[model samples]
Target: MTHTIAVAPQATKHPGPLGRRPAPQSVAELLLRAEALEGFTVAQLAAALKLELPLHNRRAKGFVGGLVEQALGADPKARTQPDFPALGVELKTIPIRPDGTPLESTFCCAIAMGRADRASWEASVLRRRLDHVLFVAHLAVKDTPLAARRFARPVLWRPTPPQWQLLQQDWEDLMGKIGAGQSGHLAANVGEILQVRPKAAHRQVRTWGHGPDGPQAVHPLAFYLRARFTRSILRQQG
Candidate 1:
């Protein structure tokens, strides 16, 4: 079961829950840096999906730890193991507008933690992990009165084992599409190509802030690449 982070509008947004942001090369650093951010404070993270996160009661802190763990390629418990190889990565949470649009500016941070490829490494060792993938996201009602669909909390996503394969496939498809000189092409096709479906439909959650409730649906990784490019995605988007 997925444990949802608590939404507390009044809660302070802490960029350093684990203390000391991770470095770009350090998997742990990257994960820590990403985790330190929140929906109200990290716009860059939300922008990855080409959408905005509304800042109502948006100040929240619980997501930092969980997201950081995910970034580092670790589990929710923040531990790394052989079967579950983890890359030191970070996560940032930010907010978007009501209509899932992007703003002029958004902010977020990423810190690297440990090294996943080192033979002497203590973290889990997965042979094929996306050690350098960053995810920015936006959420909303799948269909509705556009304006009524307010911005939902944004998340920084580090691709998991399951997600990595789909992205890799999308990358191949995108290359094929581009090679064929196809027009009107965007990142959204990757989702279609991978058959990436949302776990829920027409669902909403009440956040700590004052904006509208949660989105009617949440794509597992769509916001970051629904039709856009995430930092990591951009690196491989060509």
Candidate 2:
């Protein structure tokens, strides 16, 4: 039986709530002004690791890292700036499967701080926690790290449980959407934890012509990686 899957245009159109922030104009400026960064540049990190990252990927990682850092370490002088009170943040990429098509570029912002009696801090932190992904996704597009000049302070931030849950959910939803053929581009608001979807039971199985083997679900490890990475990111925050 043939099942026609509907390719939703939602991937291309940026929804009002799932939008990204403005791109950084200058990578150099990003390096100088963001207060959240702890001194490692994307270029420096890649160079140290001997990994030749694409220009865009390098810029995206550094820039997102800086933004996440900002969420953790807010600047007092930049009172006009949006404050982030999250305990920690991380950067990741979602690539398009088919060749020539540009993958949806994004960075996930995990918030670990819980608001209690810290009213002022909570206000600033709430803004950061909520808009963290939007801010970092915008920076990722420009390939620039946060500008130290724009920020007023710095700190070594970490993550907590709530933050881990956020990351897990984001990754799972993203993978599930892609697995379900929601290609072209993805939005930041796709927030359902990856799990056995209701439609998964209705999948149309097809045979693979590879050697003597029939079609089988790829090793569960492929899906396990998502969980593994989530754990790794959490460890980094700790």
Candidate 3:
């Protein structure tokens, strides 16, 4: 499938929601721009931006996120820092079922299994990726065409104190297990609010990890926020 980059229009010094700069200068500006996309359909957005929609399901995985970033003037390319690095905010595209429940776990980032000994909850990539988020929920029904999904209003959020504590505990516990040479025994059900799962494009992809015999080949794993956690965020927003 072919993917095209959409260029946002230029903004005046005092721009309205639709005419805002491609890269918003502040959090308020980002939200205002995002809110402007509240009810647009995938096809409508594609037409407005003159972009092509993916023909296959698998190829459309990041399509909505890319669309939102482009609409709000974000870099189409992935970055080590937040999507809006200057404002320290990450943009997440969440697919929701008809009942308004999240369709899947939120992917955090690739875990550094071999570097667990040097990793800390406060300094971990997962924490940094989640510091602040702008969640854009899209309606996704199974077996439906990509262009039919509709966008919901965006919600900005940060973890509450209790939520952060729970996340920190899970991270510490999992890192401890990795440090103890038990990565092979780690399972998706290991954490309460977070889980570690294989993250590569396929099972054949592997990375380094600690093992009984020292470093061993293991499937690359990434941290994911549990659906329950995300559901709570949505419920709280409502």
Local accuracy of candidate 2 as per-residue lDDT tens digits, 108-200: 222211211122322433334333321221112233332211111121233456754664555545444444434223443345422221112
What would the TM-score be for candidate 1 when compared with the true structure? 0.31
| Top-down TM-score ranking | 3, 1, 2
Q: Per-residue CA lDDT of candidate 1, range 128-219, in tens?
A: 22344344332332453222322223333455676666655654454343323331233433443232222223335221211123222211
Prediction RMSDs, each to the true structure: 17.5, 18.6, 7.2
Scored by lDDT, model 2 comes in at 0.30
Instruction: Rank all candidate structures by their lDDT, best first, as comma-separated numbers.
Output: 3, 1, 2
Error of 2 at 211 (Å): 24
Cα lDDT of model 3 by residue, 1-238, tens digit: 3221121232222222332236888999999878777667776776667678998867665987777777887754546577888888888888887556788898888788789867888778778778998888877878878887777767888988998899999999988888767877898899999998888889898788888777888777788999878877876763
In terms of TM-score, the best-performing candidate is: 3
The TM-score obtained by model 2 is: 0.24
